[model samples]
Target: MATTALPAPKSGSAVTVRRILAIIGVGFLVFFAFIEIVPFVLTVANSFKCLPAVQAAPQAFIPLPPFGISCQTETGSVRSATEMTDGIAFNPTTEGYQEVLRQNLGKWFVNTAVFAIWVTVLRLLFDSLAGYALARIKFPGNRLLFFIMLGTMMIPGVVLLIPRFIILKQLGMLNTYQGFILTLAADAFGVFLMKQFFESIPGEIEEAAQVDGASRLTMFFRIVLPMATPALTALAIFSFQGTWNNFMDALIILGGNPDLFNLPLGLALLRGAYGDTLRWHTFLAGSVITTLPLAIIFFVFQRYFVEGVSYSGLKG
Candidate 1:
């Protein structure tokens, strides 16, 4: 039997198809990026604006009068922010920042920072340890335990709120920083994430450490842990951002005490003023402050975040 020869497609047509796909992909990316970024740009712009300016035209981003400079007339009388807020170029003010600072925002800032930092540290240490054990340890029911943990992640976090509240109440940890910290320190997702990353590491390295008379703890801390920086950094970012931005948990735990509120809860408190005088500027200023640290952390260590996510996806 004779087989007919198949002709390959022309190179020019293939190149044209590739170019069209690339252009379409780039267009979609740009469209989505704009959608995601516009809100952030508006938020940042509005944070610098006075209340009237923000309220009058929240979409305005450009500054007419120099930023941090008061809007004024030739007669030297101050102008209402609304006067220039209709246009793209509006007067920018530091009043929002000042008012926020004047509030008990300092205490909230400290509380948020403490919660985020402590939780991140604990998660990195505890999660990595748990993950490493689940990945490498040959104990009985290890897979069972790992699967059980993954099961917890499937349950809605809100479903656990009542139970968590009850547990904290029984432990007399409600409204206490220590209780809140301990409650958030170890989570199933972190364990699973770290476990996945740890499994991707070569076992030969740990064996070499053991052969050199290193204890399991020493080998983990000195050898394996160092190699898992990407995952650790990613975990740190996630833990800190989650803890820092957490409203429901913080509200449930610390709602009884305004003095102990984190930034999110505290910002929510700022909305209680009368309808006409809600202080939108102050609220926006607080929001910006809340987002700044997380943004900075993500920008600084974003490379590691990507690597950690990629490493965690690798299956043995």
Candidate 2:
């Protein structure tokens, strides 16, 4: 007697497993997105709420009506609702923003901008020159000099704080914008980065230029630098960001002079003055303002950032 043929295993199981995995991946993405966005959302929400509402219901993103509802304080006493509106959940308030502006936030912004721009530009020029000389120019003890520069990179920046301060004081540069700008302009990393990029470029390009009667300066400016646009752009972005976000350097160098303060220093001062009573909305507003320029620069020159990372052998 012929046995009944067994049915083949269903192929649908494999497809079902893949679908489940895809769903799980999408779920993970959604979760991370929420995590990233929650702080900004909370900040925006709380910013609109009156001070009392924010303190009363710190976790409550939505503004609840005054309905005689009250919250207990540390003193175990119930306090009446002071300020809140039920119209919009998260409305924008210019109070915090206005305070920032009133306190010369514009000046801090300008200070940061000027420092970032000058440092970036000067670093590009000087670093490229030094890098080129080290990479191609044959001179006595060139290797030793390159090694010395590299060694400086290994030294912790914090360790140099006192020494740098002393030198600046000796030069009478403390509390001056020139001091801040010039110190950052002379960057070792920039030189090292440019040197690596220059090394990767074929020597044949420079040799050919020299063959055509181009002077060394002409070859560097016209031929080498032009081709190094990708590396240069990357360096510029890095230098700008470093100078803009720099806190300790600014604090140590600029001291207590609010007039010379950068955004970071100013924000720190705000936090110190406000402390626990600091308005979250104002803090967030200041954060938004401070972050805007870097965001713009990064987005605009994003291509260069990518090239710089990948081509310069620098990891994120």
Candidate 3:
């Protein structure tokens, strides 16, 4: 019988190496997920528990009680061991929510919303306009202007604090909404982002519009701007988040007026006045309320925001 040479034995080492790598990758992902998820889970769980329960034993998963807190059992309601011990009962209370609201959370919410909306809208318009002009319009010092704008972005934002404050003071805009909104309404990064997105659109589209007797302004507003929705959406979301979370600038510009405090400023005020003895539940509740709008906005527009970031490669 002709002994056909049997194929060389497969390298078991290679298969073993791949298995090790696969195991490592899975382990890393599980570890990373655990790290990321634990805090959010803890926050949600703690939000449901009463102050004493959280303080007494924050690590506890089930609500302990004299408060009679228990989830529905398979055979109707069942009291947990925790429920029987504490004469206090476990139940969801809106006291935290009520306290946040009663403490002028509504005003802070409205202030943040207004600031974010105005800054976003204005930044979108101005940045896109400047970007389009820099990208497409030929004018004296155009390149220089673009370079200056780019250079401005490189300057640390913290460095601008004193200078910006001085300028605002000189301009008599201190403590005004205009001061806060306009301070960040035309960011260099936003302009740069818009410029890059505008550049990505083939010049052919704008040329065709021009050939059809469309004015530059008309083509930009009606044609280019409409098609740049992804970038604009991303810029808007960024602007909103930045303005909403703005604390230092608002604090410095608006002074210590409680009436003028934004969400972050207001939150900080709670801690400053009450110190560590402050109601942890109330503070967390306010945080939850403050975060909800941004979370909703992000989820709703996440696709566009992600697309814009990917396409722009802003850092790169």
True lDDT of residue 300, candidate 2: 90
Candidate 2 residue-wise lDDT, 1-316, digit = tens: 1222345435788557766877898899999999998876666565544345554543446544443232344576533234343434332345557666887889999998998899989999999999988988899998898899989989998998898798989999999999988888868788888888798899998899899999999999998999988778888888989999998888888965899999999999878988777776567667878988887888898888777768656532
Q: After superposition, how far is residue 114 of candidate 3 from its true place, in Å?
A: 0.5
User: After superposing candidate 3, which stretches have Cα over 4 Å from the reference?
Assistant: 1-10, 58-90, 312-315
Give the number of colliding residue pairs in candidate 1: 0
lDDT of 3 by residue, 78-183 (tens): 3332532243334544455666789999998998999999999999999999999999989999999999999998999788889989999999998888899889
Query: Against the correct fold, how does model 3 do in TM-score?
Result: 0.85
What's the true lDDT of residue 114 in model 2?
90
Provide the overall lDDT of each model, using Cα atoms, as 2-decimal numbers: 0.82, 0.77, 0.79
TM-score for each of the candidates: 0.83, 0.80, 0.85
| Winning model by lDDT | 1
Best first by TM-score, ranked: 3, 1, 2
Candidate closer to the true structure by lDDT (higher is better), 2 or 3: 3
Question: Which ranges of candidate 1 are over 4 A from the true structure?
Answer: 1-29, 57-59, 64-67, 70-78, 82-86, 272-277, 307-316
Clashes of each: 0, 0, 7
- Runs of candidate 2 exceeding 4 Å displacement: 1-26, 44-88, 310-316
